[model samples]
Target: MHKPVLTIFYQFNPWYSTIGGIQTLINTFIKYAPNEFEVRLVGTGSDRTQKVGKWQEAELAGREISFFPLFTLENDNFRSLIPTTLKYAAALVGHSFASDFMHFHRLEPSLAALNWQGEKTLFIHNDIQTQIKAAGDKNAILWRRFPAAYFALESLLVRQFSQVFSCNTDSAQLYRQRYPSMGDRVKYIKNSFDNEIFYPLSRTEREAQRHELAKRLGLSEETRFILFAGRLHPQKDPILLVRAIAALNEPHTHLLIAGDGELAADIRTEIAQLGLSNRVTMLGALPIEDLAQLHRISNVFVLSSAYEGLPLVVLEALASGTPVVTTRCGETPKLLATDNGVVCEVRSPECLADSLQQIILHPENYPSTSCVRAAQPYAARTVMRDVYSGMFTRWEKRTLSIAS
Candidate 1:
């Protein structure tokens, strides 16, 4: 009964405040792993107090949470991170923990872990090159420049991984085409949402709660709120969300956002310059519970990101029975199969606005539940079981091969 030690490495605060879907997926897995397996999640970066290599161990929902110090000097031209990267690398190299399987959430840590030889799984969540290839405008050009170092690092990481999980197949194939020798190692594992937590409530109850909450917050009944929740980063294209909402401001539709990011202030300014302050409201960052309630009350969920791995938030919205209208960025098409929502051009406010208008004008035409039940396979526990079954089968053979 020797259960293998599984070490998971990712970049997140690992707190309730982190609002990305990747964080949701990892946290869900941490909250549901079997009793026999020892799951250790090592992450860097949160508050500014912890410096490089300073790690603290804590418990979360019966899982081991290891916090590591991470620092970086970011600028418009380049990000100086070698010092912290090497320091974190040294700490990992210094540890001799017997991990039967090592899973890395982000490419940076996965690349660092790849420096040493072991059975490893790396998730190439998105492909920048493919995104660049998918690009049709000037912003995509900016991604090419700002993400060169990151792409080079991911290339190095992919070379050392035993298995690869890509959020989409096109990106996976693009990366694999680079390494002709490493065949069948790359596969697509789409994102899933927690249906149990995000789903339809009673119509009467939802209406009453929505009415009461709106009154409590001093929101008007005419505020037909559309929501877009994610970090305020370039990838998310929150500005586009603002522009879309602004373009559709007819004194009846309002856009309420519930997330924080580096570009929070800039997005606010865009709302003002576009004369949209009255229509757009930023709730900053709220807890996941509050986020779900907001989703419940929303008419539609829109994701304006320029790119994504697999946008789990879209799935969560669909699961909640709130139809979605997001851009065709990243793996959104893969994540949402049901005709429950609409997809528009990435960064095109006009396209987004038009889609929103259609949904808003014909709200009764859309079904509340569509293809949500089809997402059961993407659950963390469900996906993890498939991973474990495949990995253990290989491990036993490898061990037996060595024994023989």
Candidate 2:
């Protein structure tokens, strides 16, 4: 008796080793998916060639999940994506016998998945159009050249899948508006996090972890810290965080930044110009263990992003029992609706400073348990696994009914 096989068509093979929001989701699914269902991944490579590789076995949750690779032409750019989509679509159609249904991680690969003969589900993590607009002249040349074509492709892909899952309500609304025919097919599924790795620590355990982090960062144990963990990019608005911290000028308050990107130098300059060099420490990108420890020890977690698609870090912080002070971005309003943290206006250092000060002055108001409970519904193993299982069952029944 063969298990029901679900084929996930993605742009890249996010084998548990890689680090990203989507990779984390893939890993979580693999770790907790029902035993009765077998999962396989199909993806394209970065190489400038056009060929489909043989199916190979990869491990997920101590079980094997077969991986099929479709080589891309050139740099996986717009010019070469046409051929890549054709090759992958052909390969998927040829291997239709291997999969019961298909899952797509983004619009880029769904174009190919649409050609395959199976039920398809699409997971939309971000609003591409919003991001393109947010990018705002950063890559003017590329945007000018491909904006129209990209929009056409995106519009088509959004309409092709009958089952669409978005991580936030905002994206779901956008999808429904853009493709009214999709109707209730667009769902708002919150992103998940590993509760085992991010759960609240006991006071004793937290004290120990705080000591460890303070020692590692050469800080005094008495120093209260706020943590920010994400890429140091324009979209993330790390500089705004630095500016906010500087405006506060609280002697006992320190800001700990984890993660590195193009804005590292700019952040460093802002810290210096604001004379907050001593108050700020950029720990660069941190390993999962270290990041969890930082969350466990910090008095608060901060996110000053210009935009987002329901950031996993906020959930991670909440799971670790740390209150968050974040700019109103993406699904943050919904996440914080439970009184989990403070919400500030985007790109407003004054507002951010005020929110942080409020949390600081009344730290006891945000209970550790409240923060932890707010995160329970988004646990990686629990919520996301159930969502996938429910969808798979519903899709299976729908397919059977159609066949009958």
Candidate 3:
């Protein structure tokens, strides 16, 4: 029997250079999806050296994936991407490969799926309008300038797909309300963490890891370390977090930053200006294993992003038995509804500082075991895999029926 073909359309960079929550989700599916179906991941390349319309192929975990990258761009500013978008859409439609169903990972790429006879699914990563508004003024102005273009890509494409997958309850609610007629097509599938890679460590193991991290950072055993492990960008609001660290001003309160981006210099300058060079250590884009170890050792994981769909790092932190302090962004409230962590106001240094202080002062109030338990439901891959498999099976059956 021939396996059904499932094509996924989106912009992906296997290099991990342009990382985000959506890329993380796409990577997870690529890593874990069973071999019952033939998968084709169609996307743009992250490597700038790759020529326009170039097709690259590779095998991952014995599964082959064809990567078709668009023409190289000098930078990632989406404002100048209308030409790239048209080119990608043309390439996708012109491709000869036949698929039973197409899974689109973003609104921009859904343009390729238009008028395709095969069933199509939309994966809602984040609210495009929310993201546009969250972007700083200059970028926001581009969207306002091209309101019709944004509407056509975001609103119209959302309705074009036959099925939609919302990564969190917040996104699920947004789609259901925005497209009431497509209510049944919208489904919620929470993002998950791999159990083998992230889990709670024993007390002795945790202590040993903590000691090593402390020694490396020149921190004392009594020091309370707070970790921030996402990109350092305007939307991520790392500056707001750095300001919060300054406001806290406790000698024993140490901040461990575990990622890098365009704002690295600004963050370093802020730390120096605040006289926090001794207290703040920026690790700068650590390997996954090291990041997981840091999560295991840290007192609290903090995410101060302006918005998110459902951050996988938060789940990883919880899986490592570390509590999280995040802004009220995306599905954070639902994820933390069980009192697994604290949610503070967005873009407010004072509120964030106070929230972190509460956790720092009364660590016992949030037990490590509760955090671990709260993340257990999302750790296993069975549910997520089943959802994808079911969708593929249904689409495959529908295609066969149409042929008969």
Each model's lDDT comes to 0.68, 0.74, 0.75
If the candidates were sorted by their TM-score against the true structure, best first, what order would they fall in? 3, 1, 2
Off by over 4 Å in 1: 45-57, 62-98, 131-143, 146-155, 334-338, 399-404
The 10-residue segment of model 3 with minimum total lDDT is 72-81
Ranking by lDDT: 3, 2, 1
lDDT winner between 1 and 2, please give it: 2
lDDT score, candidate 1, position 247: 71
Give lDDT tens digits, candidate 1, residues 214-290: 67667776567788888776677788788777677455677888888667888888988998876778898787778
| lDDT by residue for model 2 (118-163), tens | 6677887766667667743354223335678878887777666768
- For model 1, which pairs clash? none
Which scores greater on lDDT, model 2 or model 3? 3
